[model samples]
Target: MSMVRYKAIIAYDGTLFHGFQRQPQGRTVQEELERTLSKMASQPIVVHGSGRTDAHVHALGQVIHFDYPKERPLEKMRFAMDTQTPEDIAVKQVEIVDELFHARYLVQEKVYEFHVQIGKPRSPFRRHYASYYPYPLDLAKIERALPDLLGTHDFSAFCASGSSVEDKVRTIYEATMVHDEALSELVFTFRGDGFLYKMIRILVGTLLKIGNGRLEETSLPKIIASKDRNCAGPTAHPEGLYLKEVKY
Candidate 1:
């Protein structure tokens, strides 16, 4: 028949996989999906992901697109692929899209959430998903620092040390910190047009430093002005970060 393009919403617990992108060794979400699709079609198949999540990072609503010459029903294709994938990775839904549709370049915005547990004992079951800080945090200080990060700015200060991107500017649409005392969890939520490498983790680290009285709340602007990664706080662990959603 004719060629067809398919789009799918994928979710996975990235703890076991190397990362979203395919690698020569170690399991990866994209590699596994492509391998299954290749077997079913009896031909080579490649899956393109909207974003590249680092190792040990999870995605709740990741998008992927691929093309094939054979026309198979979307539901049946999903079922066949799901059967081959491990329990940690799941295909949530699939649809046929126009040939020009892409999973990555067409995205409008992305939302990421970093989960942190503040004070007291840690939950054994959730140790893999959340970052635990035993000391008390000053929510007021963190809230005060949020506004400085709201508008567009050069985010070089918040990026990881080894990032190679030349342009460090990014527009943060919204930045908020919420605390659920009952759950004993602190959630840092950010919606942005795009992000620098490890930007969110560094931002969260700086906020935690401010909350712990190690840094001044007013120091945020100066940190951003410095445009140096070393001036920022430590990069938070990857396990606590989640790709919450991608808005097209």
Candidate 2:
């Protein structure tokens, strides 16, 4: 039989796993997934993830690719992996793709959401997924700041200090902040071509400072010009961030 290549869409609550990549000691999404696939194929299998997500960061549409010598129906492949994977990690779908298809290189866009709860107390159910801020925020100020973040620009100021990527420019296709009164949560959603290490977290941190009146809306341009990591606020918690989707 010819070698069969398969692509799968996976979703998982990342709180339990170390991250997407396999680690020597800790449990990881890739390790668990490959172990299951290896069993089904009766051979060693390696899975390639679209990108690496930090620990505690959830994903709804993470993509992965793997290969095996034996050809199996897609449903059987999905069932085999799902039955073996941990409850927190699930295989949403599977499909056969061309041999040249790569999970990381073919990605066209990615969307991420950051959740923040502002109130007197934190909800038990949301403690693991959302960041809590006790103080009230100025929505108007945050809205004004969003415009400055639109369009392509040098985001070295918003990225983590030690990131080695030479190109710091990224386009923000869309960015919006929404308040859900019933859930008492503030959600920040961003869609971009790609992102630098900790870029979303830094953006949220800076916006929170502006909302709390610690930074003025007019200062955003100066912060961008400074191109200094210190100019931005603290990196938001990883738990609050979720990879909502990856567009091909």
Candidate 3:
């Protein structure tokens, strides 16, 4: 029988897994999915993700594609995959697609969100979900600074050093920050054609610095222009980052 191409949207609480990609030693989201899929297919199966999420980083709409050796009902396959996956991961939707569809290569855009709790005592419940910041933030300054990040640029400054991809140019379609007054939390939304490794986390860290006056609001242009990783701020905690959506 010929293999069938299957595309799936999934969400996972990544706190326990090492990351999205499979590592020889640590647990990973891909490993769990592949294990379940291989068992169901009665053969080894490989699952390819849209992209990788760092350890402890969550996903609400991550996408993946895999090929199964046999034909099966899409709904049943989705249900089986969902139920068989560990508690942290969920198969949201599944569909058959053309053989040429490639999740990573065909991706057109991605949305990411980074959350921070501010000026409040830490909540035991949210310790692993939201990053905490005790400093006073100037929302106006941060808002004003966000526009500087829009449009195309070489974002090597914001990228972590471990990334191997040589082409660092990416376009930002939208960038916004809003405060959730009820939770005393700051929510950052970034829509871009692509993001470098740990790009959003590093951007959030720099934005926090600018918000708190450690870095001037006007510093974004200079920092981005530098294209030097050391010119950027630290990478934020993985706990506070989420892969909100992937657009193909």
lDDT of 2 by residue, 90-140 (tens): 888999988999888998889999999888679998988888888768999
Residue runs of model 1 more than 4 Å from their true location after superposition: none
Q: Return the top candidate by lDDT.
A: 3
Order the candidates by lDDT, highest first: 3, 2, 1
Instruction: Find the number of clashing residue pairs for candidate 3.
Output: 0
| Per-residue alpha-carbon lDDT of candidate 1 for residues 41-80, written as tens digits (9 for 90 to 100) | 7889899999788888898888999987677888997887
How many backbone collisions does model 2 have? 0
* Candidate 3 per-residue C-alpha lDDT over 1-248 given as tens digits, one digit per residue, 9 for 90 to 100: 78999999999998899999999889999999999999999999999999999999999999999999977888999999999999999999999998999889999999999989887688777788888988888999999999999999999999998899999999999999989988878999999999999999999999998989989999999999999988888889999898999998
- The Cα local distance difference test for each model comes to 0.87, 0.88, 0.93
Find the 10 residues in a row with the least total lDDT in model 3.
119-128
Stronger candidate by lDDT (1 vs 3): 3
User: How much is the lDDT of residue 178 in candidate 3?
Assistant: 87
After aligning candidate 3 to the native by TM-score, how far in Å is the CA of 237 from where it should be? 0.5
TM-scores for all predictions:
0.95, 0.95, 0.98
What global local distance difference test value does model 3 have? 0.93
User: Weakest 10 consecutive residues, lDDT, candidate 1?
Assistant: 117-126
